[model samples]
Target: MARSLVDLLTTHAAHQPERTAYRYLATGDCDGEVQELSYARLATRSRAVAAWLQERGLAGSRAMLLYPPGPEFISGYLGCLSAGVVAVPGVPPQGRSQNHRALTRMKRLIADSDAKVILGGHEVIAALGRLAEHLPELDGITCVATEDIPDEMAAAWREPDLTADSVAFLQYTSGSTSAPRGVVVTHGNLLDNQRVITERMGHTPDVIAGCGGELFVSWLPVYHDMGLIGPVLNTLYLGVTATLFSPLHFLQRPDRWLTAISRYRPHTSGGPNFAYELALKHAKPALLDSLDLSSWKVAFNGAEPVRAATLRRFTETFAPAGFRGEALYPCYGLAEATLMVTGGTVGVPPVLLEPETGAADAAAVGCGRPGEGVTVVIADPEGPRELPEGEIGEIWVRSASVAKGYWRNTLATRESFRATLPGHEGRFLRTGDLGFLRDGELFVTGRLKDLMVVDGRNHYPQDLELSAETCHPALRPGCTAAFSVDRGIEGERPVLIAELAPEAVGESEKITDLIRAAIGDAHGLSVHDVVLVHPGTIPKTSSGKIQRGASRAAYLDGTLAPVGATAVR
Candidate 1:
């Protein structure tokens, strides 16, 4: 009777077996161009796909999945889970300058994975072939059909008897280069968190979002946890119609996500901080005027640090669209924890403290409370001891959902999970994030290793970015980054990179000077360098995080800076 992730998913399949469990590539028509799969149907498809693999002598095979957002991707992912195959999700193709690196790294991962077959759609396979031109090793990968998908393949298992500790999937996180690390999560880990999210999302009577109300609407890439699990998995267990869209399609046309919501009347939507910022920048004013966003209930912000100004401006701009101020929900999560760590209470306005920099003591937007069987504690990392609630320290989590650890790296697994928290019975996952608890909720600050020591006082790059963008007329708020210069010298102060208004390109000197003076006077943090780039020039992850490492590398290599940008720095 032990619980397992496969059991958990199958349970949902049993509950409302005929209810629509997943909709891939939804259209705006009355019936919509949706590829609807009921829980029963999905379960059948998953087992059949697994069976197909077994018949082809591919059971327990290692495979890499590379496809854009759609039904085929989901089916492939589930089939891998069902067959106990090692599923390695590929990062979507970045631009030309970055594609080679992505391809090369992907080839290495495939090689390291010993993947027997590469499952992808036609277009993805074609792209893989092109990538092979850059990386010769890619040619050996057996590119095969993921679609024409055996309309009626037999089931893999006649009866389901899944174990809690079986390998479920490999979650990849970006490293400095295009290469990423794969974090192994097990069945127990996925189920524990899925159950937690089901409760956290307020499903007493089964929280449901109809076409226009409380529905799950998202455009984040499925390669990410928030996209695959957040709205997708959460909605399924709750029977809410999860309206899906691809971030790629949205990025190509920013209005689609909002337009879908306005038309579908979906109340629940989530994305990283960058999505909201992009909406403010790229969303047409005419589209904004017509958006019926009053139904928006929970706007879960996570994946990256939440910027206060970005949240504020988003609320203000969307207010005209009937979006309420309280609709903005600032939360925190990571794939290592399955998806959501701490989320704001359902149907309540979120907690918004001062801007990250304004608070000298370093306060964060609270991530609400620990969800089902999950324990969170802030401890002094020098040794395991509880710190005062208001004081900052490392955030440690112990939960049924916390993963076993990185797959092949015993050292990393040993480092990440250990018996530390006094209240918890099991080992904890050191999130590598610094934050604290207040009252009863968790608040995320920043990464432990990334904290910059400027002139003896501790400073965070996020903090500096907040100060740079604050109350600026020309520069949009919360669109800045501060990082210490490792200029091959000691005691190098941090640089300020602010996103300037397109029209204010000529006012670079004044903007930089203003940013420098403000940081120097307010926080006593001197700006060693100042650079102005067009908005969005600084690379961000799919979750909308400022790639500080990437930006720093670009700055050091002299690739990101513009012609006149050198004048100020």
Candidate 2:
């Protein structure tokens, strides 16, 4: 039996040493300069880095991996696994700003994990050196450049003993800094989730053979679970090839993603909802004419709320270019569940649920059913009673892919992961997401934490944000945050922070009133505060999900500056 992922790597290296394992597109486009890594070179380099870590007695300890967008980060991460060190992947600091936001997150992760070693690229290592005076905690940590580790060290590398129960890595969610809860993902969790992904997405050797062998193009950040577990580790698990590029490139030109898809003809590719919208924004006629997406079988949309509008628009927009509507796969998952929990059936169009009383466009899209060996149930958040089908409630999951628990946070681990349903003996993972099952299909509604309650009525923030976006053409779509704030004597009231297009910056007050009136007229709830700021002012997580908690904090701290004029209330 295979002991761990390292065992798989060793096997692949021995059998198909010359097979291309990964290809990094430097310019984001397929025709740009490429950096290729074969199975043999990847194994050798990872072992060399492992030997370096072993020389410093870093086994069984946490090693924080800080590398820019490239193949080196993958090698360093795999090296940690090979060396028996817990890997903590984090964003690396860029630019001369010593206190960059990414750097801040890295510092907090370092402190929380108590990592003893730092594996990074040369530029990142130098940047940390420049900020060593400000961050004294990093001074004692041993820093090594994984790319600089000599090949000679491979001889000294020893494969560490690993098992299914051994901790593989700590996947720290975006909002983890405030609460500091790191999900303790074990080797078993990784392998099980990979199997779940394969089975759910129909990713078999047949698809691989039909698509000309393993090919996946991704611009998602490797630090995030979707990027790490979805594409990076899945490639290693299947011994397939993947093409990677920086998220910066995709954002600069969304068309590059589709172009890469057209050139490589990948069997699987996906991103968040905003990515589809961005692609629609830039899909000009000339660009669309050059694309051929027929080979793309599974186009997944996850890591955020998957909008029915987005799926519809993307399908209609790219249909002429051979993009199939059935290829649009909507899935739901979180880092706590490892990566994927429920994925849509491959080669079938997604199902849509019309709203009970609201507008037709307000309908919720089904995120598909639970994967094989996974049980999903909608439970009343107030108690453990399971709710009937079509009744919205907290999403609970039970599967082998569920992670062990939060690292060193026993209370949080038990509260979130050890939830038991009434009359049921098995524990279920509280997903903290509100959704329901209809005809065995899961439909995600909103986050439980971001729910706004007013006049004894619960309202989802995404619903209000959508209302604000559609109320006026000036308000940017998918860029509004709706949250509730406590008023002490008055009670909790709803607040909306919206981003205005450039031309509408001068008419912020008009747009703000329009949004407030629209919400009141539609939802019957008066908006307490409406702050229309410039575009991109609203905070978002790494995966581009609106951070309502962060936005609330910003509002309370008086940090938001409305463009035209508005009183603080």
Candidate 3:
């Protein structure tokens, strides 16, 4: 058995040197320009990078990886692991010089992680040098273009001492509900989670053999946990082939995803719920007719709320293309747990519960059962008692896959990662997500911090947002934010902020009225106020989850600019 990911790569390279490990699509289309890296070549490149880092005596230090979506990022990341360096994966600066927002985010990550080196593509490294004068964050940090390293450097590579408890990487949170914090994940945590994923998703030898070997296709951002651990590293874990494309490409043309799936016929491929919705939006009859997704046995969905409507629509729309409803897998996970905590059984349809009274949607989809060796318990967020099945509470997790804690933030690490239940032994990770377990299955409800308590009734913001978005065609899907504002002694009042389509700017009043009525009818709650802003104004995390707290702040400070007229109730 491989002791670490580095060992796994070395073994694969030795046994199957010519096997393709990864394929990159420059344009996200099947026929577009492509790049392939075999196991042997990838191992050589990784060794080269590891030797360079070792020569600089940077072992045990943090190295920030800032490369665009490509196979190079994988090499840089694996190189860090081989060198016994803690890797910090982050988004690279884009555009001509450097985007201010992107630069600011980069600075925060650099300072937070205290990364000593920055490994990026040649172009990104060159741009960083040009702007070094203005960026104080690069004052003492070393920047290297890993692509420029010679393969001969592999001869000088020396294996560093590694252990299961060794820190592997710091995965920063998406900052949807709060500021991002780096989650400290060790080698043991990583390997255990990979096992959990494999067991829960049924990535067994029989399944792979039936599908002609393991394969995955994804366009998720590499900097994010879902993209990195789920599809990318899983490929390496199973010694399978994975075709990757830029997230920007998928956003530009959602149909490219289906095109690649039809062309490659991979056994597993999927993204967040929004991804399925986007694909459905562009599923023209001609496009659907030309695709064959019969080989896709696992269409895993997570990272965001999995909607029953999306699952039903995507299956119905792609049924002509051989997509199965049983392939629609709904799972739940987070950065704190090193990625997957719970996932649906493979080849099974997602379970949906009947709508509760005053529910926003017709049904709630179950996230799925916990992975092997993972213990999930629902506990009251305000108390120490664990809730029984079918009762909503904070989702607490205890597993080997749970990460060590937050990096360099002892207070946060203690507060979030050291929770104790009355009867459960050992520490449990406080997921900060509210959910309930029914029949041994997990059903995520909403973020504990984002849950709105109006008139002593618990209201999930996602439910309210869903109701508001469906009220008007002008309202953007997955772009609505529902939050509660404190109104002194009057208690918490619900507020809705939605992004309006450009052409619907003049219909703010009508849209606002419709949203108010829709939410009131479904959730039985009157809107305190409705603010319709320009498209893309609502705050969202990198993974596309709505930042309800940020929206609430903007609304309170009067920073949300109205597109037409704000409706005050």
Give the best candidate by lDDT: 3
Cα-based lDDT for every prediction: 0.71, 0.88, 0.90
Error of 1 at 530 (Å): 0.8
lDDT of 1 by residue, 478-549 (tens): 567677875455566788777788888888877788888888876787677888888768766545567787
The digit string of per-residue lDDT tens for model 2 on 63-131 reads 999998999999999999999999998888865543467777888889889999999999888878878
Q: What is the lDDT of residue 181 in candidate 1?
A: 55
How do all models score by TM-score? Answer: 0.89, 0.97, 0.97
Candidate 1 residues lying further than 4 Å off, grouped into runs, are 1-18, 24-44, 94-98, 130-136, 155-161, 175-179, 209-214, 282-285, 355-363, 419-425, 471-479, 486-490, 534-536, 567-569
Ranking by TM-score: 3, 2, 1
Choose 1 or 3, whichever is better by lDDT: 3
lDDT of 3 by residue, 1-569 (tens): 77788889999999999998999999898898999999999999999999999999999999999998899999999999999999999888897434776787788999888999999999899989999999999999999999899999998999878888999999999881225599999988889999998898888888877766647889999999999998998989988889899998999999999999888878889999889988988999999889999989889999888887778888889999999999989999999999999889888898989786634245889988999899999999999999999999999999999999999899999999999988889999999999999999999999998889999999999889888887887787788999998878989999999989898877788888899899999989988999989877887887888888888888888888998666453
lDDT of 2 at 432: 93
Off by over 4 Å in 2: 96-99
Higher-scoring candidate on TM-score, 1 or 2:
2
The TM-score obtained by model 1 is 0.89
C-alpha RMSD of candidate 3: 1.7
TM-score of 2: 0.97
